[model samples]
Structures are given as structure tokens and as C-alpha cells.
Target: MQQPGYFAEDVLPLLASLPTWPQPSRKGATRDAEWILWVKMRMWNRLKAQFTGIIESDFKEQGLEEEDLAWIAGGLVDAGSATSTANFHNIVLYLAACPDVQATAAKEIAAVVGDDRAPAMSDVSPLPYVWACIEVLHRNTMPPWAIRHFTDADVTHKGFVSPKCPAVVCDTVALQFDEERYPDSFAFRPERYLGHTEFAGDYAAMADAQPRDHWTFGAGWRVCPGTRPAKSNLALMLANILWAFEIRPPTGAEKGGKGSAIDLSDDAFDMYPLRQARPFKAGFCLRLMLQEGLTVEAAF
Candidate 1:
């Protein structure tokens, strides 16, 4: 599905029109460019504020404390260092956009964990269903590439050989969507991991058969140190979203008939030629149960 808008539509055209050479002579042009960049920055900040407000509002309505809300937001913010904050923010924004996952997670948490107290990290862990949902989101929506590595010495993998300085890349999308690893690879079936019989005897062997294959957080020494903390934050946010709402396709949208069907062909971009695009849409409504018995709504 091609997103109707093109990359050059909004700001790119203006950026492309600017002078690129003889910089010292283009003082006025430089000032204009700087001003435009500042405006773009402000626009981004406003978007962030709006989403942050939504999350905060949800927390408040659940009778959570201001401090707890701040902690949750801060944990997400601090998961990546300053340089990676924007990437982390983008990930959170994508998660927020997925209404079905959010509603399911919130419902599960509310039923299993309850509203008498806020969820602790430990409380969030045993909910394998929630974690599996998070895994799917991460696998499906993660950036298409990680930083490329140049092998410093001869490297052998299986029978293949590569010399030093060969460019090595990680094709995350392919790894995540491999059909052999994930039978019915595109379906969103949380129960796939629910019971012992479903996975057979060896847990490790069963895990190997799924595209929960590689580390979405990269691998070895350079694996994202932030992976654990990031997952924790995601688990919490997802739990909250699930506990608070119900997700469904927008009215009049087509639904797969009776049996399981998944549309995995959603258009996406690769590392190079990156462009802005419209994402698939699903809508959500807050569950009334959350609102019925709540206290200290103002603090959150």
C-alpha cells in the first residue's frame, strides 16, 4: 500500500531548493534555512507534547500518581541516550498508534493485575502474553536496519567466507518475517505462545522455530545495552494501554472473513530511500470499567 503523499511534498522541496555551495556568500540564505529548521523542530515538539498529553491523561484517569506518570515517561525518555532519544520517541509513537494491541494489553493487565495498586515491574513480567505482544510490535515495526559493520578480519559463517572490510548488514525484516520460523508468519495470534503443548517439550527449541530468532536489539558486544530497560518501559506502557481501552478496526473497514488472515504486505521503506508514509490505521475507545472505580484523577 503506497502512502498517497510523497516525501518531497511538505519540507523536502524547500530543503532541496536551498543553496548547497558557496556557503560564505549565502548568509541570508543560511539564516532563512536556520529559521525553517527551527520551525520544523517546534512542529515536532508540539506533536510530542500532544501524544505525551494523551498518555498522561490516560494515567490520570486510572488514578495513578503524577510521580508515577513522570517516572514512566522518564523511563522511556532515558532508555536511549540523548543521541538516540528521537529514535526511542519514534518507537513509542508507533506503539501508541496501534490501538488493538493497546486495548488487548490493557484488558489483560486489568483482569490479571487489577487497579487496587499500580503495576510493579515484577507484576509486568509474568504476563507472557503482554511480552509476546511487545515482541510482535518490536519485530514488525522496528527500523529496517542497524549500523553496518565492516569485518576487521576474515570471518566464516557456516561454510561462507568473507574477507576483512566486507560490509555486513542485518536484514531485520526478513529475519522477522521468515515463514519457516513463524508458520502462518503474518498472523497476530498471541496464544501461539500460551501453553506448553503448543510449544512441545523444549522451550528453547520451540523458540528457535519462530522469528523471535535474532536479537531485535542487535547482537553480541554491540547489542543494545538499553534493550532490557527499553523492554521494561514498553511492557509498562503496553500494559497501561491495554488496561485502559478496547481496540478495533475503524467503522466500515474490511475485516478478514471468519478464519485467520493477516495483511503483512503493508508498504514499508528500507534504510536507503527513506520516506514519510501513512501507516495502517486501527481505532480505540477507552473501556468504561477503568473509569468506574478510580481515585485521585488530578495527579496523573
Candidate 2:
């Protein structure tokens, strides 16, 4: 299936003219512009059809206004895409750091997807470990704060009264690693969210109310609506990448692997200005044969 995009080449610039939207200068858009631009055109057409009519508001018949259109464009371009992109970066870093996990996922992809075609949504049902890696990535690298939420009514929970009309911040790090819920919260364990069959459909239910898998996408009514899409994108992306190439740390004259070149320094996780992940380096060499890699399918 084709992915969605923000908007048209010209219409996007017009929408982005809003004060809130950042007008990023177009520089070197041609490094790989041919296919990239074509893909974007298709995506833009897909999204354009959805915005022609009144956008579905939070109930109540509020017609789509100019401001609403701007908000929609902003939400599509930044709010949703940024976090998912960040998650992708974090997942890549995790796989580069942990070769064993990457190898396991690669094995799974080879078995289920084979070498003929790339991974797809249908292949997701059997690729639990790959999905588990995504879960682990979410748990390990969560946004410091989820989208700020406001309480609608005076509610009390665990002995505190959150009065109505007050902004609330979910301490995701604390909630995710609470000693009660997760025994070894600090450790990276994808298996924590695994064991359930058809995890693609099951994991989201676990995240609602009280998060079971991870807290990267937040929770409750205001939770990220792109949660499922983000996961699906992450899974398919990882599968496709692993299927085509064997990613490893840059090697040098020192003989063996020099370990992951990924730097998780202050600059690395400096998730400000749209939570953009700083660039990092990793080795990607095309694997000659994809199906040749298999390790006696161990049912975990």
C-alpha cells in the first residue's frame, strides 16, 4: 500500500505560509529526487483527496476553517511524522548496537518474507521478534513528554485530585519503568511485550489507560492516533532494510568490528525543534543471499 503525504508541491508552500509553520529552504532536493519526488507526488494525491471536505473534528459540527487546514497540515507534516521518524532513528540505533537482536529479526524476515519480495503488512503477523524489537525500542527510547494533556473534569486518582481545566504531564519514564509493573525496567527487553499471538492487533489495546508495551506514543483519548501506522511503518522499514543489507558497525584496521558508531550523546538525543534525531553512521552492505540465512526456527 502507498503511504500518505503532507500536501501538494505548491499547496504545501501556501499552507506552510502560516505563522506557525516553518518555511524550510529547499536545498539539494535532487540527491535522489527522481523516485523520491514521484513517491511524494503519489502520497500528496492520496492526502489531497482526504482534505477536500470538512475534516472530522472531536464531534460537534465544526466545519473546516483556514486555521483548521493549517493545523491539519502542521499535524500531518510535523506532529505525527516527527515522532515516528525519531522512533525509526532510535530503532536503527538499537539494532546497530545489538547485533544479536538484529540477526534474529533478519532470520525471521528471511523465513517469512523470503528473498523474492520485500516485507509487507501481511508478513507482520508472523514477525513477532521484529515487532518486539520495535516495542523494546519504544520502551528504551521514549519521548521525555507526551503531547501535553488537559483534564476535562475534576478527577482523583491514586490519592490526588486533578482539578478540571489543568494541564497535566505524564511522567512517561517513571510510568514505564515503575518497579511494580516492570521488574528490570532499565534493561532493554523486547520479550516483555511478546508471547501474545497476533501482536499487531493486540499491543495497542495494552497501551490504552495503562500502557503495557511502551509509552513513546502516549496514552488515553489524546494519544497519538498514528500509533498503529507508526508501528507498522517501523516494522516494515526494519524488515526491508534488514532484508536488503547486513548493517554493522564501521570496521577499521583494528581487525574486528569497532562496535556501533552510533553516538547517544547529548546531541544524539537532543530531541528539540520537532524531536529530530541527529545524524549517525552505520555500515550497510548488500547481503548477497537473503534466504540462505536461517537458524532452525526456534519458537519462543
In order, candidate lDDTs are 0.51, 0.63
- The worst-scoring run of ten residues by lDDT in candidate 2 lies at 1-10
Model 1 segments more than 4 A misplaced: 1-107, 193-213, 252-264, 268-282, 289-300
Deviation in Å, model 1, residue 130 alpha carbon: 0.5
Model 1 earns a TM-score of 0.52
RMSD of each: 13.3, 10.2
TM-score result, candidate 2 = 0.68
Q: Per model, how many backbone clashes are there?
A: 4, 0
lDDT of 1 by residue, 105-211 (tens): 66678777886666677777667777766555555434456545788899888998999997777776677677877688766654454442221112223335342
Top-lDDT candidate index: 2
How many clashing pairs in candidate 1? 4
Quote the lDDT for 131 in model 2: 84
What TM-score, computed on C-alpha atoms, does each candidate reach?
0.52, 0.68
Q: Report the C-alpha displacement of residue 223, candidate 1, in angstroms.
A: 1.4
